[model samples]
Target: MRHHSTQIPESSKLSWMLLPTKKNTDTVQSTTDVLIKAGYIHQSQSGIYTLMPLAQRVVTKITQIITEEMERVGGQRMSMPSLLGPEAWKKTGRLESTGSELFTLTDRKGAQHILAPTHEEEVTSIVKSMVRSYRQYPLRLFQVTRKFRDETRPRAGLLRAREFIMKDMYSFDIDQQSAISTFHAVEQAYRACFDRLGVPYVVAEADSGNIGGELSKEFHFVSAAGEDTVLTCKCGYAANEERARGRGASGADMYEVEGSEQRVVVPAMRRPNLLKIKQAWPDCGELTLEHRKSGEEVASLGQMIALDEVCADGDYLVDAAVDGLAVEGIDNFSNVEVGDWHTAQSGDACCKCSTGTLESQTAIEVGHIFYLGDKYSKALDLLVQHDGKRQPVQMGCYGIGVSRVLQAAAECSSSSRGLRWPVSIAPYLATLVPLENNMEHATSVFATLSNICVNGARVFANNVIVDDRSYLSPGFKLHDAQLLGIPITVVLGQKFKQSGHVEVQLRVPRLEIATCVAGVDVTGDGYEYKAFVHVDQLAEFLVCALEGQF
Candidate 1:
């Protein structure tokens, strides 16, 4: 078995590519190109990746965001073993419930063990043994490490896979209110982490798969291709399939077709067909309906539009002039589509800005945070002594899709040429390519670029590749740079050799590039070549440019 080195060089490049003596050299090179060019994931074996320097750096950066937010939101870090004793899982009935998802094995002692798909049982058992009082009422613990799941289909790159990194955090509270508070804190942290990652996301209601819980939510970056479908309401409510609500029951009262108003129905419609209903009653005042079965009533009218005037009053319902008026109840809340009016529209509550409409886009769900009531604690009998009585502790769990994030980055940032990475997630900040075989000039240019990169690195944000092969051509190098998606590339060629400056290209464009060199140079080449910038400055420039686009 061949094991690749896990040591990340300070220079952040692979010292050597590992290959079995039997594998063809050309095949290995091809594989390397496919992995590096597509993004910064290099396979060390058939199923494992080496996480080339650039990819590794992005992973680390993402992890830092997770850590910072977790800490800020009251999650204490704890390192749980990748290999957990099967007995602990069996204690919670998970060994029987999650059979195949668990990676089971036997040690030399013939004792059974299972890789932890999650740490709920382990964390609960530990807390049960250590805590026996109310003082430790709201305890939160977490771990950032690799997790294993025997996935059935590992496709769409790392979006779904067998083994990957994860940050799982567990919280314990004596009361439901405290546990809910802790849960909201972690949820806020998750939002912050995604924000830092430069990805747009929403806290959608999600099913607690395997991890049985009452009130659970998934933080989804909505995408058409995303695995989980999130349904959001124009009223600012959003949830995954597990927690999404359908159209509820509206009152039996009919409305005038010619009037205008928006009404809130109790037991909201699951599959609201506004168009179908609108066609039925085109002039009805904004109406509210309720499901007869649910028996839930509206507490207060949220927002109502009476014709052209926007009013916040609830008692004003004009008499309907149409005899065919009827209230409908829908039962399917599957997913939100591009044109779904059931979803939040413009002028709705914004997650960040107050002015913009509540827009929805696609994003892969790489992580989730949930507040698990005593569902597991009561099931597993992991109770603690508090206030002279033993009671089940409220729990919460937070997870980060260590591997899915990598794939999401690729999916969002790739272009026709190849996978261009955001500098924040790029394996290398920049790739130094010398266009021709002018060894002397290439070496000199490499040194100059290396010096600038080192300066950036000192500030905790810089990377570069010094081209030493001296074999590839300018066009080839340019193609490879675009393919790799590095934010910046420095070209050293016959032209650069003739002048003191290098032709720096920014892989990711920004307004600053256009502004910095605005009116500086222009030629009617039929293509809008905006500006010139140094490779070292590209990362910072792009960072500033893309601050809010996500």
Candidate 2:
């Protein structure tokens, strides 16, 4: 995409009104702000955005990467209806379970419908009708499409938006063992996908929220504007705050459930983790938990109590702990053990590693994978005959936030002047910036580099941008390159006008590429560097640089 051919921002439209004097500062709330300031995206509403051409290029590249990874794991791409009937979600009990976060509508026929948030329910119903025997086990289906979440307060641009692009894959296996294997296979694919982005990320144990699952993990990009809190220890133990454990949180014994009608009053407000009781007993609708912030003494070890002694008189705690807690088929609150109830914090001692201190950081959740064991399949009655018996199919779902990832990558690489995008997802591989009077010479170089290919991938042409906007000053063009976070930049100015050598600047580090060019002149002042390569040697230099031959 050529800067001159860009017609949306005419005249002072390129004005850096929102450009912060510093990068990643409080002035810049998120990459969304930077993208908007740089004309890469435009805010259409509170949580909705219109991706400009530059943003589209980045998203397209991200989507392509996701597609490759999904396919590598035998995923077949398919599209499901964006507007879905409420019946499937209802059958799975997610209709009311989803609550306000769901976007629902009443058609002219008075039928309720919802915009797709995730495809679990829809895909399960489809597989239920289509596949019957175990012969079709290990099937994988995926799609890259827009999704809606009606966020109460969308923030950080694409990071938490009402409308977004997501790549969701659903897998079906004949049994739990097969499903676990398939989950790991897709996990590696997710790892590959993030690794290719060239951005730093972390995989953490996570709790499956509304998405019912037996196992879950999250892939996150650490960022200031990120919404999720992740705790990591140097020893490689990591988990979302909700699921993280700390040595301080001791596993304590609690009264066992006796009669099905006994009700235990837990301090819902003081301990958020205990509220997951709803999930602990999903099948028993009678097990209701009211969320309320209670006193610190609510359920501390100091408040231990006996189940038979539990009182119905609303005196929440007795004998220093829980007295009456009852749920059908649930023998105890053993699931909320010591460490499980504690949300790991910045200074907590890592319980798993025992040697490392857990450090807390905020991160954007770019991808999530869940192992659904007989949840959706059982709810939708998707069964398969195996060993001469019909059994519920095991399933897994994997998702990568395509748009959020674009924002996250930029946010992760943000710098003082601008943000350095990973080479794989940058809008352009490199930008050729020419001073006002050097368009002709820069165009010649651009044309030449446009045809160069390296490592089986074309590094130029569509992947590169030439700032030929003659109306802008050379200084403005150069600054724009830095603002857009172009991984590599080539400048043809007075140096090129007099001599045949051009300047190359890397966005992230201050380094010299003199090795790529014969008779290369290199100079640097610590934070910035310039490598002058003759016009004749520029192509070879870039090919080697792009190929990582350096």
Candidate 3:
């Protein structure tokens, strides 16, 4: 037998009242079911999802934007196979270097195959065989296709996925100067793309990593869900996590090591704390510790620690070549951290801001462009004859993570209640509904709104759905309307019948709502009164509102 009690503490009673109870559980469940039925989208794996109709429509529009931008940049588009041959990757050494990261298999005839993580080797191979001459000094080519990475740990919805879409591009130039220009050109094109999408981003120094390049830059869109960390400064200095260099003052040389200076040998005490040694021997002044591991012929002071400190078990001996008495230790060459004297300050000069100091911020990279130079062309024998001299074609690569943008947008703008999409990416601009079961009033209002939609007004972009289904309760319809987050909603029912006008509700204001009552006058031919502010006016308002926001 079980007994239950409804007991509440005096102090907790008020807070409990504010808590959401189980009474709304059924409503939430019903909403989820409706969303699934409407085919918004469904996650099959941790980060992989199947886009339903509603989601598909949004993504299709985004893809169209990307296509337009790529074309505008003079990028010649093409499609490559999702599956690729292993021979090209093997020749580049990535087949084994990338190891299990490369998804590989054997065909029926036992021919090696690999799902490409990137297309550099393949594109270079094709160019090697097709191009011949310096005349084709510069070339820009691209493709929007599906790529597989088999990420070790995929999470964060579409922000990190095993299979995703990417716009990978390759550029070729005759020389280093031309390659640098091509890189800048691609960077500009990427900026235009994100601008059109209405997402804020920053370009920062980045490491090419295993991608194999001398220089690289990443475009990071500010969002919490972003996986990469960015170090930013008021001086307009931004850099990727791997390439982040904390601003610091190069400290003065603590100790000078003259070739002939002699210090007593201490074999049992092989490691001496440079800082402590200098502190104990104040007359010796600052300490200059050598980092033997740096492999440089000249020994430079890498770091300094407290003097008189005994060596730990982990510490190792680096016999100071100067006198052999001042032994160095493993702990001397550690990385610098924040609060160091060398860190960048607010007043530092910004390359972008000119005289303005740099400011630091966090952001996620959504796109990147790399100029490959002739790394691939040289490997694959890709060459062109120009003036009777065969030369390798310069190449560059560009990438945009399509799925990541959606998650980034969601991360950047959303509240506990629901998501507030940007105007350019909102699922729909308006939802039309009648407040109560007044069929005549509701029907008449529908006709009026339909005309506004047909006129290509800004209130709706062909995605409006009128809930004329009479069986549904007004409460349920209202709940759906809110969940959809439509910018505007119109209610025509019993309330309007007495008032003799339709009610227009604008959901544009943040956490607040406003309504305007517009008179409804039906004519003899069944024509309703035209709105004082026509659909064109509504369109203009929407455009202006969105323009100011993004």
Candidate 4:
């Protein structure tokens, strides 16, 4: 793990990845682009990518954390097939239901096979054959493997790729109560895993989405570049837009009644909630609602009005003709049209706690947990004998999109300088930079770093990198250091040569994260914004910082 500048790839020198978007920049580049230009990944196909060595190192650390957390929660590691037969999927109706996302292929013998996007069918098949006695009622089996899906459009780097790494765990239990208990246990493990990653995240209610389940939640990293829209309340109620529900506006919002000179105002169900409207009018299956902007498809975001810009009172009072009547969308308002209208807005009262208003933001989904009753077990015939009667085993499935979490960490953390990472998953813990053409000085500091240890292990050698490219300028090295995301940087320069001190810089530090201190020989140049340490007390300083004591 000891790396020198020569050992690293040149693609990593693309500092252009961190370029900030200027005013009126029409296109916004996301973390995916940043990762590509920075040489962490390479696109092999339209929706497939190859992780570079540095990216692989970071991915390995993330996998290790997930594996440790999985083991902590009583999960036994095991591998399942990436290619699955269609029988079980057919039985579960997922063969047809899974639809386009499924990757299907035919062998030379003309037998069809599927590249699994998930393993519920395969895992259930395993349990059906192996576990039957109620004594073995509770079981948790997991695996870290590559998964495939035929994405219509894959963007956002590793966040939504056709092929990616995933950690999937399946839980089996004898009864509903036991299954729910197992679900909570796995939930805790997910929380612990994310907590260790050091990025802020949210646990929001979620829809099962192609993967069938009864109870579900999503673990999200809030980011402007995220594709999923999430609605949250200060009261702790959060859900993805697909599953989020807001109470109907008390009164029909003011609008111009189409085909008439009358402006109307009344309480009405928005076209945005067309499905809910259909629930009230079961027979009106053909009903359709449109946005007031020329009545285009209302199902999209063009219909959502910002609550903040609207009336502060939540009562959108308008001086209409006063002849407007209150009626739901079902009472023959299908052809009714108007100008721009309103739907769920940020300031709308939260459905969970009325005191809090619903606010919305986009977020990346890195993990998902589902309480998947007996659907899979029943379809796959995973029955266990209990009290002399066989019953379908209760089950649940949990998944962490391993690669998605990696890129999401970058998206959540990167400043204009470049990508950032949590200490636990950074490619390396520290970097050694020789501020002059002093390879000898760098070698000396590297030896000290290499000698540093904790619990009798050579942790530093395994987590430290020396910038040995003597041809590169000190400023260039420092600039690259910011983009590399190695937390502790030691600089050997004129000051170090004069006083046996090497300046240290801690990138993007927060005082509250950890509690440990080490002395610096002296402060850095006055022109600099901050000086982390002078690489003084080197062993104690780096050991603590790399161990998340920064």
**Per-candidate TM-score against the hidden true structure:** 0.68, 0.81, 0.67, 0.79
- Estimate, for each residue in 1-550, the C-alpha lDDT of model 4 and write its tens digit: 2233543333322221322222222332667776765567888988799998778989999999999999998999999989899999999999997899999999999999999899999989888788647887689999999999899898777888999999999999999999999999999999999988888899988878678788999999999878887888998888877666565454344333333222323335443333323233334333222224221222122332212112223334232111243222322223233322234545567777868888988899999999999898888888888878888899999999999998998888776666666677888767778776565666667768777877777765667777765555777778767766776677888877677767776663332224346443323232122344455577776565446432
lDDT of 1: 0.56
Instruction: Tell me the alpha-carbon RMSD of every candidate.
Output: 10.5, 7.5, 13.8, 8.2
Query: Which tens-of-lDDT digit does each residue in 1-550 have in candidate 2?
Result: 2344232222212332233223333476556667877777888889999888778889998998899989998999999989999887888899998999999999999988899999999999888888856887789999999999989989888888999999999999998899999999999999999888877899999988889798999999988868899999999999998887664422122322333432334232223344344454444333333233232323332332222111212232233332233232112222222223323467777867757998999999999999999999988889888998898999999999999998888888776677777778887777778773776676577766677777665666665566655556667778888888877788887889888778887664323344655676656554455677888888787765545421
Model 4 residue 196 CA deviation in Å: 0.4
> How do these models rank on TM-score, best leading?
2, 4, 1, 3
Q: Choose the strongest candidate by lDDT.
A: 2
Q: Which residue runs of candidate 2 sit more than 4 Å off their true CA positions?
A: 1-29, 249-272, 275-339, 509-528, 544-550
Clashing residue pairs found in predicted model 2: 251-338, 264-324, 269-292, 269-293, 303-320, 303-321, 304-320, 304-321
lDDT of all predictions = 0.56, 0.72, 0.55, 0.70
> Which structure among the candidates has the greatest TM-score?
2
Residue 427, candidate 3: how far off, in angstroms? 3.2
lDDT of 1 at 445: 43
Q: Is candidate 1 or candidate 2 better by TM-score?
A: 2
